[model samples]
Target: MKFMAKIELSRHIPLVTLIVLVLCITPPIFATKNCDFPAIFSFGASNVDTGGLAAAFRAPPSPYGETYFHRSTGRFSDGRIILDFIARSFRLPYLSPYLNSLGSNFTHGANFASGGSTINIPKSILPNGKLSPFSLQIQYIQFKEFISKTKLIRDQGGVFATLIPKEDYFSKALYIFDIGQNDLTIGFFGNKTIQQVNATVPDIVNNYIENIKNIYNLGARSFWIHGTGPKGCAPVILANFPSAIKDSYGCAKQYNEVSQYFNFKLKEALAELRSNLSSAAITYVDIYTPKYSLFTNPEKYGFELPFVACCGYGGEYNIGVGCGASININGTKIVAGSCKNPSTRIIWDGVHYTEAANEIVFSQILTGVFNDPPISLDRACYRK
Candidate 1:
């Protein structure tokens, strides 16, 4: 009997091995990709702004999109922004701006970013002031409205309503914040001293933390927070400041110092938020280091002119005139033209980064090296 049992076990070994091999080769029907985050909800300023501000202000016209899209898409850059790249990485459709009244489909995501938007509403401004209705606070309100509408349609059993379940979408989607740069820009342009600007860092950090908490209450769990890049390295800043004050890289040193200071404080604030919101996966992305690297080592990034704007006119950095400016050159109308090769430059206009630069910075941001807690977006969204 023992010999017979041994012979039977030996006969089953081949069948078991085949079963194992089949299982290894075939993926589970319900298995999800690591980077398959369900949706994205973006908020901030022009760096990620697709068309929100443009819908209202009619800015970023003509030569602004001459590089890639070959037509104005209301994006501050010549082409796509960082948010577009993030969406593409996850196999998601490009997000539409929330304020895009002309047939916006929110099944994928919505962008609430607007150029010149500030984190907090300025006190001195009246309620009817320009762009006041589209501040970050207003964006949050719009998000609430979107959720309510989506839930209503889903409950009504509409055909496309099932595309996103309200609870699952909010919980699984990544919330991205890329604001603070505009706040700093406003302070500097307002003639605030570096010391005075530093004084406002606490309030700025607090406001951002408070917004995160509010979004947490709304069921958002994953956040990708971007630190301010080297604003002093922007061609606009270089043109505005005296040449004598610029560093060896042609970037204003004091402004960059202020940006670094803000980033430090912001990081600390995010740490405290992580401790407070135990279930939240909040990742702070260091956009400064990678962006500064491109400026300091342009050759490595294939950028020949890291300090110059590819679509501006006048001045050493071609930043004395803004993109799309129409100048009367010898009584003939001459529009500021874009460079022949926008891919070879880091800066796009005087203020924003080229699509190529945004792509590079976003690639670094996803490597887990720039993220706090060292978790990449793929790992953060992975089910296992």
Candidate 2:
């Protein structure tokens, strides 16, 4: 009779060497062709703000969300903003504002963006002035608090646990940024020359990078950072500085140039960050190109009145008062109202883009043609 001898591989191989062998053969989680982003954590200003400003102060009045939602939804656009389209593309629920306490569900993620927010802290906060108190630093602090609070609430294992994001969602989520526009605008509004505004770009970009680093340190790996758009093309900017040089598209050339400079510095800083943070997937999205294109060729993209406000009082750009406010015009009270057709207009309320414009911007950006390193939003999870 022959007896079979058992052979144990673990006995002969060292524990550390066997562990290394196992790790080497296994593929990284992000190496998969299909990159799944479980949630979206966003920080920005009005361009992507869902409702942070509104919750902290007052919501925009009627006709703001009339184009799509048919009511006020606290978004700056006529209907949805770029962030709403982003959430829809991922098949996730729209992000609830972190400041909004009424019936907010953060299962997917939260938005810390606010209108008039800057990467650097503003001189005036809410109740004292128009600028938001939720600057990038403050937003990061809020995010940190959110993490700790949500973890504690989720650990209780009740119905609330289903409402909060899962523990793994933080690392698996995409972090978006659409700020820095206000930083430039604030300088111009403060009576600073274009050169002065340009001079401050480096410091503003540095503050932005610092906030990103803080967020990255807190388990954020996937990032979609949007470059500031062409503020010069905004109706308010155009109307405010009628003497400024205008491009062929009627946008203020100097203001737009300042914005381009900011984007340039931001891109350079992000490139350095990408090299340093090798594990992070940081994408610099060129929001300026697509937004500027809409202004230059509004008709090409089924848009008209590119520089005109869809809901303002008066002027060549149709902006004299706030979108939904009433003003006394020659002893007669008149309310600022939306245009007959908001879908045809590019600018919504002298500042933000209309829903139609937002959709167009989203479509163009999703193609990855306007993104640095040329990666689409869906593929943003993997480092290039």
Per-candidate TM vs. native? 0.87, 0.91
Candidate 1 lDDT over 237-272, as tens digits, reads 787776526778778898999889989998899988
C-alpha lDDT of candidate 2 relative to the true structure: 0.91
Report the Cα lDDT for residue 168, model 1: 77
Clash count (model 1, backbone only):
0
Q: Highest TM-score among the candidates is held by which one?
A: 2
Query: Worst lDDT window (10 residues) for model 1?
Result: 124-133
Clashing pairs in 2: none
Alpha carbon lDDT at 52, candidate 2: 92
Candidate 2 TM-score to native: 0.91
Candidate 1 at 346: error in angstroms?
A: 0.6
Which regions in candidate 1 have their CA more than 4 angstroms from the true location? 1-35, 123-133, 157-167, 382-384
Alpha-carbon runs more than 4 Å astray in model 2: 1-32
Candidate 2 per-residue lDDT, tens place, 1-384, comes to 123221266668888988898889998766667567889999989888888999988998987888888888789988989999999999999999999999999999999999889999999777887788999999999999999999999888898888889999999999999999889988998999999999999999999999999999999999999998998899889888999999987999999999999999999999999999999999999999999999888899888878889998888988888899899979999889999999899999999999999999999998889888889998999789
TM match of model 1 to true structure: 0.87
Best by lDDT: 2
